[model samples]
Target: MFAVWGLIVLAGIFVVIRFTGLIDHMLPAGDPPNFTFAPETPVPQARNFFIACPPGRSPRTDRAMPSPSFDATAATLADVMIETAPAHGMQLMSGVPGGKPGRLYFLARTPVFHFPDWVEVEFILPEQGGDITFCLFAQSVYGLDDIQQNEKRTRAWLADIVGRMGPSG
Candidate 1:
């Protein structure tokens, strides 16, 4: 009976910490599981994990197809991402403005959990001067499922970026 009581108390503390949003600070800095820019990056099977911008687009929500591939140059597209993502509440990580064909990273925070969700973006500029394209990968920082948060976020952010690019874009 005493052990049971102790277990209950521990569980209570865990709930409190999670609810108060205090657990995010104690975690070490790094990308979450299944967070990768490469297709070979393995995703662990679990309930709290989710990944967007996958190969072949099996999960359609994870995919974003912008007409004219965003209608901008490598630098302009990178600027769009840098300028627009934060408006949607994405906190930019390091390595932004990484030259042509920009490589940007960010963390997406949600009220659903205290852990961070990771988003990796790469802008591809044509060597011979063609349409600009980009790839984005987003996934939960923890758990097996993200309730489609990554997908939803990527879609919304893409729309916002396109909008920011304006009439020319």
Candidate 2:
């Protein structure tokens, strides 16, 4: 039937797009700093994103540790993120404010469909000199529902980071 043939052609086109990396061009890599990580409403209502805020701020507590300075903590975070991302099918796209000690953005692709997702992480250092904290926001670029994929990926990354960072405060 014509409908079946059309479907086959469309599927082939999608496969080509995925293989050729054209999907990256089609999906927008949103502004990292613009992502909201507020405690009251960390994630959007669409169930396509997950946000982990600092302790005492959100329902999910982020990993934190005592550090002598922000630079040291940022370096540690960057190393851990770089090591862990590839394991989860992610690659660092860019960083806000030039580089770390600020926000980092990553592009992740789903295993099956190769759907694109953007993850933004911001390192925070309290003025009072307490523990260093970071907030992470991950969202799908082309879906209204990700079936909790963002949450699972966020949790897995956090666990890996925590393991690499050793005991947290």
Scored by lDDT, the top model is: 2
TM-score of 1: 0.64
Per-prediction TM-score to the true structure, in the order listed: 0.64, 0.72
Model 1: lDDT of residue 58: 20
Candidate 2 lDDT by residue in tens digits, 81-169? 88899998889877444445477788888986677888877777656655567777788887788888878888788777777776444
Q: Which pairs clash in model 1?
A: 46-144, 47-144, 47-145, 48-143, 48-144, 48-145, 49-143, 49-144, 49-145
The lDDT of each candidate is: 0.62, 0.70
List candidate 2 stretches off by more than 4 Å.
1-11, 28-30, 40-43, 59-72, 96-101, 126-129
Over 1-169, each residue of candidate 1 has an lDDT whose tens digit, in order, gives 9999999999999988887767777653364332334545544454343333424422333233432365567888877788888876687775533322356777777754556777776665656756676666676666677777667777788778767776343
User: What is the Å distance of residue 78 in model 2 from its true position?
Assistant: 1.7
